[model samples]
Target chain A: MLKKVHCVRLDGDKAELEDEIAEEVPLVIFVNGKHFSTAMISPQMREEFVTGHLFTEGIIDGPVDIESLKVESNTAKVLTRHSTTFLESRKVILSGCGSTSSFLDKKKLPKICSNLMLDRTMVLNAMKAVLRSDNFKRSGGFHSCGLFNESGAIIVVDDIGRHNALDKVIGFGLIRNLDLKDTFIATTGRISSDVALKCARANIPVIASKGAVTTLAVEIAENSGLTTAGFVRGNKMNIYSGGRIN
Target chain B: MLKKVHCVRLDGDKAELEDEIAEEVPLVIFVNGKHFSTAMISPQMREEFVTGHLFTEGIIDGPVDIESLKVESNTAKVLTRHSTTFLESRKVILSGCGSTSSFLDKKKLPKICSNLMLDRTMVLNAMKAVLRSDNFKRSGGFHSCGLFNESGAIIVVDDIGRHNALDKVIGFGLIRNLDLKDTFIATTGRISSDVALKCARANIPVIASKGAVTTLAVEIAENSGLTTAGFVRGNKMNIYSGGRIN
Candidate 1:
């Protein structure tokens, strides 16, 4: 994306109307040359998006299943050849229901094993960091989510949507070859079932948000043994489940 | 909507988060009980939503086709069977693109009309008022869109997603039995083609936003003869097409 913006309609000093021409990048994900999805995203890291998308969608059980990957035009083309071992695992083809109602029947919730004791201060600070540095704050056109570890330090990535933000971070971790086990994710948006399911896909343990959590989201977190937190403002929050700082 | 929320994670002595739970309201459009699409909307304004929906979709060529109208909630239904004189028309089904893209193939631009003029003061002022009162401002939740008259004064509603807000206003207008012709819609969200299409469905002549407008949206607005505006702020905005200020 270009850093400079020009106004098309100027009523005063402010841009009442502006002409903004952006350079578009392509993210092509090819499942064995059979294209899966094409995403137009920031070109900072292409492989992260591809790996994150594949892993989140359960296309590959482990990173090794991905035979080859390519990133172009900010587009990440993930190439995985047909193999019985990969196919027999039964990946549920989910209609992308990012943070909304899903088209498919709800899958069995993810069961968590590693309960993460959240560092509340780290979360609060991370949230402030997110707000202060948000691209949306400048442009008012983007959404983001963040991931953390037990220490509550900000890790992972941010994107245009809460789902995309989380996906980018997961993808980043995959490209850099990071661990998925016992990770925590924090969002600047609501904790709906769609988000919860995304966390489950990553095998994340603790999920926190600067916004509200829905009833079904809480239920999913509980059933999955995932620690859910919402409204994590400075020095305060509501834990929707077994996630409590010990 | 409920006011005076108390959340443990809220800013100290500051505004709380705004949350509006969605409910299914039966919007029965009885074109001779032929059963138009079952619209899920707020129950408060059954009639207005129906009329606005029908008009925007270009279903009725002026409101006189209907012989009578009635609205109901759970058991409430709208008996809107049109007389045979107007029976020559069938409701146009405008469906959004499939879920994966969730974006319209916007390159297919609509025909542009050059006759629409809006009050600049009204457009900017309406945007200010709606943004000033957003749930995002108070509870830091929800997105908002406002419908404006050719005069530019905001008439109906605002919401969480760009789509939901427009729907609420449509639902509100439909229930109140308002005139939707020669209207403009303003939003704080990105103006995608789907967003443009939604406004087009209502036959809204102009669509404005404080955020970005996609390429497809520009095409749709041009072809549909809808004026498109973007990057609306204090005193300035970008007029994409079909929008002229007198």
Candidate 2:
């Protein structure tokens, strides 16, 4: 995947730099030999995306349920097989593009838990620390997603796609066997349905994005009991739903 | 939708000025009483996004088969109670996060006529012209997409969302009854499958963007008879496929 990266940064007209590296990656997914989708993502997280996308999309539930997940780095093929009726109903197919967006099942948003409390100082302090973890400051492109426990320290995953970043966190959580309850998914990208859905899929209760939030995302959070906050910079933030700041 | 907008222009750590105005005009889609997707886009040409999304995604054939295409200001929604099969298999969705990305059906790309003649230089020049069309210089955040004929002038759309911008151009083209063939779509974002599908959806043979192209997008264009190019900034570009430079 690094071999396919064509780095051509222009200074005036000519290429300031044109090099091949494993940077921008294209992953094509096949489900049951059917072309599921092709995504341009960081090659590092193919399996994570597979398990995360399949699980979060409600395609399948857990790693054990996934029959197998394979990635061919050169061809960029991510083959995923499932062992459940998760792909049942054959109801909706949406071509969701971006680091984070609302994909589907808006009605399934998690019920907001009532006992959680967010300390403004903790959240703000985390922002300053999160900025240091940005891979974008090094690569010039990429979105970062973080997961924090009740104490709000940055558990970071930086990737070219914000969704990938979230998946990395989810995967990390899975690996560490951390509980998702009362946790929050924080990202540098906009809080859309896709982002909210992933949090709901993980059963995380609160989401905070340093960017904007779509109307549908707000509606999904409001209706489903998931707490959402956007433009969450400094001491002030817009509470789109779930009533903490409100 | 305007109520969902929060504006802030910062020289540093301050909200300096804030107001809800119709600044980021682009495209958004709704399906069956739910907000499906929205992209920051040019307001003028939205119907095409509404139509092109359907076509490239294999949703519908022509505009007449659809029920209604409507746009008020920056919001565009195309609705159809089509053959139920198309609706049911439509769970996987693509919503561009105001950023051009690759998240589409690569294995099922549109087949072009194969006899189409694409003039590369003309499209590249149009790409340069597109840079000046952005209101992003004012808003500081937005992407633009345009469709141009052989003459090199284009109908351009700018938005915070690259998908919306492209959709606006498509929408505008449909309303004007414009023929997409011998024309090209130029964008200030990446040349990804979703964006490439915009041209393929319009049956346009060429697409040029002032950014990178995903490997899958290049593959789709090469096979779809759609010529693709990327990184067009002031007299330079790399031809990804399907056109003669002369």
Candidate 3:
């Protein structure tokens, strides 16, 4: 998902030509033959993307719920029992109830009931592991994610888009039937309410990031009973929500 | 769309609980009462977002095409003559052409024919102006944009989302009837293909950023005939595409 291109580089009054770049493609996803959404992403691990998107968006419970996922060029056709149901649900929710109502409802989402605990040192190491990935070091365009537990970051993935990286990690978990409730998610993407909602849906109790945590994400994390930390640089971090951190 | 939140700060091994955060919300757009897409955005510039989104997506030519924009709570109702046409076009394109062909078609977008030239010193100053904004200095969460020309940065806007920031700048231009072809866009967000496409649609020839540029963005800029540069920092930059820089 990359391409070599000649670029003019300027540094401290010096100029030189070089070749480096990662390709990005617009991937339009269709659910049950209906258009869902479009994302500019790297053309890889698309099935994981479809599965992760459906599961995290509350469209499906797990990867088993996806009947099929077919990629025709840049488009992904995802089939699931709830494919049409999810679309209808979005329409009903949007047309019937106001957008703010839905926002409030999600904000008041059920608390994630888990007893997961994370060590500061371990989480810092996990953040370091994500930062050490070739994708981050090379492209600087990709987002990275690592699923962590008491042991450490067990599964790691990267994608052109931040949300896609998290989705890939969740999809991996769903396929492995991992106990998500006890899992902690470490990522290199800004933590938004969308990310918080996804973690809530997956029953993830802790989320740590090497980036900033927006206000809504913090609120969602606090309300949903998830522990979230941001700015995981070197040995420092900020826990935005939940009080279970040690 | 901001809220106050209490947070726990950790430096190395020390921790302190405090308050510091900016809010985020989901803004759902409806055109002619039909549900469009939902965006996670800062709520300040809903109308600009609607107008810019329409203009940049090639849905409407400019702000003159929009008849009205109404915000009821968190939902934006945009009224445009091309609303139905745009929706229909998306459906037809997605269903009829599939995905890959459309992707290729966009990738081969014609070169921007504008002969606008930008000086390195002026652009570096523009980037500095964006970084000096209160939004960037205070929140550290908002993405910023500054519309520039021969003189310097003219209009600057900030939002939680990078796309929204660019939209605000474009909407500002549309309302004031600015000559967009001669404009240079300076931003503090990653220049993805979507962003490149927006500049192409606006007939803008120069896009400079203090962030990374994805391969797709470079390709789009190169194809769409726009001069694009990234990693504009302290007296340095890398021009990925186009040759309109002096």
Candidate 4:
């Protein structure tokens, strides 16, 4: 999603120009005829983001929990086979990259168990493939995520938020009944604790990125038995946990 | 804040190394002894972030609206003169950079009115000053925000979240009774609509960044009568709204 806008370019002298900017929309999620959460994301991949977000948020166990889901414009209506008790007690307003509700508690997190391993070439290639997103290259404002196995990159998605991109990727895999434990994710955003938590909740084996990682993210990944690789640039990368790279 | 962690660096061969990652902590806000919201932020500048956040969220008009504020370990206790009715009706779980509650509505936003002007050198210097944060330079995971006037940078703060950094900067100005309308902000993160709304609400005249801008952000900036400069590089930048740069 790119939007053209008129702007003034300033160099040694001012020059008028038109530039492309990434579009962000507010997607409100309604669960069982009630408001659940709102996420700011790119216009593409709305359904995938909703499914992945619900699963990662622990609102749903899997895709089967969702009876029906419809996304019209900026609103997503989801009918799930669960009570609304979880929604009543846990209404939190999370600003920025912070989610300080039940998910932040380490004891409540799910432990990832998998035997997935990747070679140096595979890790580097995945990072490259994700970084080569057309939306990011065009607008320079979108974060990208890619799901990969030993074969190659399977599904790649971009969103205004890095968390949304990863959630969309996971949702795509869940709908297709893919073995998430056998797949890894490559992202173009920093591996914060929340990002690491999403990967752990999704049961993804490895989370690789061409960005930096936070201290809490490393601790959570180490505790959850998930591998984290950051700074995956040309010919170099850092493995924070789950030394599953050969 | 940086934490030393043992990690494996993979180039052609894997080598063990010690790396520094940024630290993130959950700061739970309690208004009138009641839980308000929780934010994930860097450990430093808790008080400034709290004050700025309350003002930007429209919970308080200024620093005087707060009777007392105390920040302990990870909890910030704020006693406001206003009733908690606003908190009861508006509880939203914003997953990423989305705040679809009261703040996202453009009609409810405060239009910025200021005569602040900056030269090309001033704009470029502010961007450079903000980007030269030691925390970001060391860990490569912290987002930085700087308050600037025509002379130079005033206050610079770094946080795990960009929104937190800006809020800390605003709080610093508020506590010092600085005229926010006469100053501007420079950040090291993408300019999103929520960020632009924060500046508009705070009456900050200009927002410049070395990162990209979203389409919604540009629209909000234009509507709020604020100036937005993006891609502030060596000798060039793009002006999206309120052409206040000479």
DockQ, every prediction: 0.16, 0.12, 0.56, 0.51
* Lowest lDDT 10-residue stretch of candidate 3 chain A: A88-97
Tens digit per residue, CA lDDT, model 2, A1-246: 323443333233434344322145555655656555555676675676666666666666556565656666523233335333423222233334221233433443455555566665555555555666645454334566778876775377666566777877786675456777757777776665556667766777777777666555565666667777666676656555674422
Candidate 1 per-residue C-alpha lDDT over A86-149 given as tens digits, one digit per residue, 9 for 90 to 100? 3211224233322223423345555666745655666666666666644546544455566566
- Model 1 sits at an interface RMSD, in angstroms, of 10.4
Flag regions of model 4 displaced more than 4 Å.
Answer: A87-106, B86-106
User: In angstroms, how far off is B114's CA in candidate 4?
Assistant: 0.8
The global C-alpha lDDT for each of the candidates, from Candidate 1 onward, is: 0.56, 0.59, 0.77, 0.85
lDDT of 2 by residue, B23-129 (tens): 32324455444454455433444566677666545556667667876765545556676752333224334432222243334455666663556455676668777
Report lDDT (Cα) of residue A84, candidate 3. Answer: 51
TM-score of 3: 0.91
Which residue runs of candidate 1 sit more than 4 Å off their true CA positions? Answer: A3-5, A8-30, A33-35, A38-40, A74-77, A81-107, A132-137, A150-156, A233-238, B1-107, B128-140, B151-160, B164-181, B192-205, B210-246
Instruction: Determine which window of 10 residues in candidate 3 chain B has minimal summed lDDT.
Output: B88-97
Model 4 lDDT tens row, A161-216 = 99999999999999999999999999999998879888988899899988898887
By descending DockQ, how would the candidates be arranged?
Answer: 3, 4, 1, 2
lDDT tens digits by residue: candidate 3, A85-166: 5432242132233755466565348569888777788888889988888867776667888898888887888777788889
Over 4 Å off, model 3: A12-14, A81-83, A86-102, A106-110, B1-3, B12-15, B86-102, B106-111
Pairs with backbone N, CA or C atoms under 3 Å apart (clashes), candidate 3: A2-A23, B111-B224, B111-B225, B112-B224, B112-B225
